[model samples]
Target chain A: MSGKEALLEVDGLKKHFKVNQGWIASLMESFGSGEPDYVHAVDGVSFELREGETLGLAGESGCGKTTTGMSLVKLHEPTAGDIIYDDQRLSEATDAEIKKFRQNAQMIFQDPFESLNPRMTVYDTVAEPLRIHDIPNETARVQRALEFAELLPAEHYFDQYPHELSGGQRQRVAIARALVLDPDFIVADEPVSMLDVSLRAGVLSLLDRMTDEFGLSVVYISHDLSLLRHMCDRLAIMYMGKIVEKGPTDQIIENPQHPYTQALINAVPVPDPGVGRDRVELQGEVGDVIDIPTGCRFKNRCSEYIGDVCDQVVPPLEQKTEFEQDVACHLYESAAGYDPYEEMSGSPSAAETGDGAESTPADD
Target chain B: MSQLEVEDLEVYYETEEGPAQAVDGVSFELEEGENLGIVGESGCGKTTLAKAIIGILPDAGYINNGSINFKGDDLTEMSGPERRRLKWEEISMIAQSAMNSLDPVYTIREQIVEAIETHRPGTGRVESDEIVTEMFELVGLDPERADDYPHQFSGGMRQRAMIAMALALEPSLMLADEPTTALDVIMQDQILKRMGSIQEEINSSMLVITHDVSVVAETCDRVIVMYAGKIAEEGPVEEIFNRPYHPYTIGLKRAFPNIRKSSQDLLSIAGYPPELVDPPQGCRFAARCPMATDKCREEEPEAHYENGLRSYCHYADEIDTELRPYADDSDTWSQTAAATDGGVEE
Candidate 1:
């Protein structure tokens, strides 16, 4: 699995949206800041999806995980940076190449109810991709896709409209529609978040089995770390449009070095009441992604804030441990020389990690 | 008197076809300052139960039977005006989704102060403002944000403001339905902790209705598992989670992927909850229950009480040795109709 070819490489991806401050508000901000604001949705994100591997992109709301996923599939074009897919640069692709890319890469949205067409029959919905791709034998392909999505028998759902199906069945149709083109890669954004606990396992297992059977590269985006532990082979934690940490799912959960990641894991309620956690409540709201800070985006609420140095320079993602992936916090670097590479061999700066171990009160 | 006692409550909604029995013969008691949780999937009548308790069911909905005894008053027997007077003054409810519940046009201060004015009559705007400010501080919101509208506050903050408004009048019984469902886990934990502290300070009984079993495990002293508009199981939180007696409760426990446990095949219940419109006779869950027999299909079982846990199942006594084994086996429950009906069904 490690030696397998990389199916998708997303390098230095950035997706920023101009804040829609209509007329008067823009005029007011023009008088104050002198420049129109942009929401830094996905700022300088980089990761590769190895063939047949499921990579999870996890973060709180407005953390840009969804934006990052959307950008990769060109739902919203990448504002900057390059996406290389199977020996082809996506942004530079010609019309035919773009068509191939679209056919090859598919996406499953969070809300199946909103994503599926109300008037479209299940057969028509699933067949739309095959017809668009100009694939031969659309009807047979739709049936096969529906079966693969585990909508067993397929015939029963073919004529039914979206409203006639249950939530789980509707989601299966959405999955079937994505699989219709025989996609090489898939971007599933919180695919099972809207599902009930009883039904969620089936959908998860369906996706898991589909990826294995099809050898599909997947980017499974979700905020549920618990679900990610089961679904994803590797995990990347996003904070304010940047990858704060990335590693094996187990390593990240069991030994999360970043303060924000630790807080997230601790905050999730384990199913049993017997297990109590040492909670680290983050101060205030997640800072505005629009007015993202100059230094570490998480530095203001971080328990391991390290004075002027943290406020001055941006921390670079450095591989610290043998098993650990990149960690961007300064706590892993040597303070005296601030040498990240040399400090990687040693333990984290424990004295500094403790100084602000408890959360600081939100100032304003 | 118990803080709140709902005895043999039956609520129904008039649908286009006929009456849909939303809450059927539900009974529960909450002691003073106690916290109770009602856990069920959507349309299981948990929300209807909350609305009935708060006297705010939809126009089509009606409480057909049973007594809602809050303090010394029978809330079900109370007239419309009498119940209106009791609202926010004695029995308040924090509705789900503060974005819609909080008036968009009014500031947090104005909305909460309006609730205060209605209850405390003759209270000046300045005094009400002072009370809201105090509530904002208690809920860890910056006092300055009291002037902000519901749209201005974050989702978590809007929920906090709704809590503040609900608790503004110092109601003895508070009903919060899925208060933290839309929130992220971290925010959910913070809000739950805040609610716990405020509830303690005011010494009010809380009846929280949510589908998240983990939330119930964390917040409630007692738990009720609802299915097909009936209380399937009721017990202390520990007893319910650890030694669940009812098959539905057991299935629910096994259905969710436990983060603490090693990753394995997650247990999935095979069938949808029985449709509430003209629901099945005998045991409503018999269609999905693996341990269910011909006896289960022919006659409904009464609440079998044991070790402070009440299970509406004939085999409640065999939970540990016999029935649990069947519940633990996914093969025992109804599989999705895909195999039987040849495709997915609504």
Candidate 2:
């Protein structure tokens, strides 16, 4: 419930890593190879982040949630599409404009141990950002950031390395570094997942405070749904390099539209033993991003597989509920004329058993 | 006699400063065909306990004093070879990291067959092959991939292969130490479900050690909540989740957000767990616990029993009246911890 102004507008964002490389690929290219392969890590994902609104990217491992977050912060240059941030196109921005954007946006990595340099002291880690941005009063700024991160008596930690600090303290240092520049937004990828449960809440609450105090828009990328539900205002479920569902956090959690989203929600183990949840056992693992399915990426594992429509036509993400929820499933139609579901009783064995058999339709 | 009984187990890891009392004076019993979970945070010694039971402690670690009685046989008293003989035949372990646990050089089939042949000498190759195939099918893995090396398999598949190997012998006791920690949530759920069915099929008791409370709640019939290398609470899963008596348990339960409940504040237990090396003489959790007092810091607490529940706390009797209410509030812990700090200063 923040301002209507879109702080970041991402349209058709795509990042593909070349699978065919090295001497072999060069030789093939010399002979005029037919086509090179690519792993579609973040393929055609689009979302708008309203100012000060926290958006969560939820999915299993290799679902491109991390890739999407990395792409947004320009950690991975996009192969296609546009990233409009604060009315400035990042892909086409000049050197000065790009530097300004870099100062305004920050990213907190998943592993505090790996992300923070072991050799760098806590003081230098926080001050390095300010120094890079050419901001003055580095010591004072770093001190304020550390204090804001709840590392009291900041001067005491200036000399200490990451190894000297506990997992919680290391994460606090990372948060301090991320917020040292006082960025407009932060892309925190599994920030607290590495910390202990006791320490997790402290770091999370600190994040909550940052958002409230600074009105910082945060993009939280995590597989833990419960954590996301607690921290995020909106939820986007990614499956096979695409957003399968996007909606308000509560609405998506309570009433998931996409079958993949439903499976993900059901799979999260509830802490309360009394609530006996009916387990939605989705068959098969997440599809390979390299050889993505032609139509619905989730058709291989979806328990509610309809028919040939899922095998031939890719489902467009559209408004399928009364609330502001968009789901990419043939089960929900954007128009009234065509019904995607012809039969639901037959087993999806044809879809399951065959790989790259796009020619054979399950049903017309 | 129980299927397995650990009495006064004390495992210490040698460090430069002193011996870290990783698992100090811990005792628990597992009945035949029962699922028992040991839940705690990192460095609380849950992993150490599991490692000690399996007789796979590192060279630096040793059992100071304890008895591990399996089927009325003392494993702790047994020699290294004697304990090695019991491995895979009596008590098998599913280690935390599948990638690390699985042998990368050998094929999956070869490794499993080697395990079978080692434990059951004179076992024919054809029979071992059948066993590997059956185990693979049982764990929802393709039998054709048996020849594939561990490096070729995905994380989930590798874990399943581990389960297949662990259950190949059909050991009476199965010790899974954080089996699903490295996998995705959906993959974790699938693996847990598969483990459940396989356990039922084989009729083996499982000892799941994990820091995830929700995973424990789902898979365990009974749970032991460990803190600073001691059991803070032990009871039926329902009792632990619904009505915990120990302040640490209450704090732990509150730390995890209930997916079913709409937006609620998560209360992190203030302060870290006490240093295991030369730990304080009083209650180990007194510093972080909300109901901690001067007595808690001065004297150790004995086990207080209520029905089938066992809580290690000074104010266990007055949990409902005193501890439970304050444990949920974030401010209560901070205030109590601050007051305790002041008292320490005084």
Please tell me which predicted candidate would have the highest lDDT against the true structure.
2
User: Could you give the TM-score of chain B for each candidate, in order?
Assistant: 0.96, 0.96
For residues A108-208, write the lDDT of model 1, one tens digit per residue: 99999999999899999999887777889988888898888777778877999999988888888999998888888899999988887777877887898
Per-chain TM-score (chain B), model 2: 0.96
Q: Which ten contiguous residues of candidate 2 chain B have the minimum total lDDT?
A: B337-346
Residue-level lDDT tens digits of model 1 in B1-346: 7878899999999998799999999998999999999998888899999999999999999999999998878999999989988899888888889888988898888888878887789999888888888898888899899998889888999999888988899888899999998898789989998899999999998999998888888889999999989999999999999998898898888767665654656666666777677788889888767677788887888999987999999889987676677677766554533344352356
What's the lDDT for candidate 2?
0.86
- Model 1 local distance difference test score: 0.83
> What's the lDDT for residue A327 in model 1?
82
Q: Each prediction's DockQ?
A: 0.58, 0.56
